[model samples]
Target: MTPPILTVRDLVVTFGTREGVLTAVNGVSFDLYLGEVLGLVGESGSGKSVTGLAILGLIDPPGQIARGSITLDGAELIGKPEEELRALRGKRLAMIFQDPMTTLNPVLRIDTQMIEAIQAHERVSGKAARERARQALARVGIPSPEERLDAYPHQFSGGMRQRVAIAIALLHRPAVLVADEPTTALDVTIQAQILAEVQSLAAETGTAMLWITHDLSVIAGFADRIAVMYAGRIVETGSVVDVLETPIHPYTAGLIGSVPSRNKRGVPLAQIPGMTPSLAKLPPGCPFSPRCPRATVTCRTTMPAETPFAGARMARCHHPLTGEPLAA
Candidate 1:
């Protein structure tokens, strides 16, 4: 079998604070294959963003990838030299940050920025880089790409700016595209458009994509597979059909139940009972034990080893949910 385009093994990420070390990602592991989209879904503070950054080698000073291996195309990235990682970043892997305005330069015209990105990876001349930039913007469905290229970021609407950011990310045709809440700030219509465009682009380019979002609906619409995260760990993973159809983990079930449409008419929205555990003060066993209805003494006293539910479906729960699954 061909190896996956990207593989993460026992990945652990931690942050250094005045209080102490806080674990953000605890032994998270998954794989992304060529031409597939993987959704990392969870609520806020679930360490979804931290996992994306760790894979991209973008964790800043206070946060670090303390353990585990991030291998892309069979090369370890965790401890590579800065220069080597830098070379890999824009050329082989790219990220679409949550805030597009922050990602694009407010002072520089789109053409200048995009050209610089292309030129940075390849020894292309000024005119050639400009053409490449224009093509990328056009590819992302930006209207009047040439005209938009000369405009500064502030001159564009928020949605347009995000398109530009995504365009930059795709400029190098990176093998892996990590999108961290790429649609969070956009209106539903624009969000839908961007999601469709990204999905199509990934298919055409055979790009392995890690789409990090809190919206399970979005994952249902776009991802081939879904990995449900809770308290810095992946609690369940499977094909979109299996995970959404038969969510074995209680937390996964809760998240699905909380979706507005899942609740009955005239009823309060179904909700998971407790807040996410603090990274600095996580409970003794399963980080999600406090909120999980199925949690038991085994869940509170010792972490449940991952158990298989079905093909490629794994859930970490001693007493998992069982029955008809909720609809997305």
Candidate 2:
């Protein structure tokens, strides 16, 4: 296993909302190695997206990184000034959202946007930047990149717009790319194509990618490792095969069981009971105890320490499915 290219430890993000200081992300931690895609999967409001945003220094206003360490290529990023963070954002760190419009400007031409993206970090001539933009579009499988560069966001279809967004994000070949469900809105056919293309691109460029999504099936064949998050905490982290095949945490097992493809035809889908807890009013013990079937009295009264297993696996639960003893 190569050294992790990006590392996050004990990340805590809080927002001072009307609900009274919500802890959106609580002590989250993970790592991403170059040329590997790590899937951050969980339901909505599970702090998956917030973790990604914090990595790129995008958490603003009432939200703050209350505690944590984010290191990229051996440099700490948690406390870097805004000026330095901005310079690093689209160059060393980049992100794409589920909606292409978030990355694309409807008022600007595609070529204009890409050219500016390149020139912002490099002293390149307009002609040179334009050429790089065209090549990037081509790399992402856009048709007739030369001509399409002159068009605006409105002119391209949904999928095409997303491809263009990906092109810009990868234009600088950033060391890390955070994709928050970039293919969620596209049809299955287009989604599959983009996933393959993005994975290929990441491998070719040696870019560590953190792909955030709520759909387990989306990352089934995409990510090298999977991190299961619930209520702002990671319950399990392991290789896709290991976690999906023999999940230790009940929340992880329930999540795998809820995947549509996991069930036989005509059978009702499995679902985790109870609603996600309010960040401001989380349980005193395990945040997931209210819904976790395997939760015991200890789980509802005392927080469980992360228990380690073979193959670099870890699950934060008291009664893990595995017969291993809890850490002392």
Per-candidate TM-scores read: 0.96, 0.97
lDDT of 2 by residue, 1-328 (tens): 6778899999999999987998889899898998888999998999999999999999998999999999998799999999999899999999999987566887999999999999999999999999999999999999899999999999998889999998999988999999999998999999999999999998888888999999999998989899999989888999999988999889988888888873467899889999888888898899899998888789898988777877788889888887474344
Q: Determine which window of 10 residues in candidate 2 has minimal summed lDDT.
A: 319-328
**Model 2 clashing residue pairs (backbone):** none
lDDT of 1 at 270: 87
* Candidate 2 lDDT for residue 184: 89
Off by over 4 Å in 2: 323-328
Per-residue error (Å), model 1, residue 310:
1.6
Query: Model 2, residue 33: what's the lDDT?
Result: 90
Q: How many backbone clashes does candidate 1 have?
A: 0
Model 1: lDDT of residue 198:
89
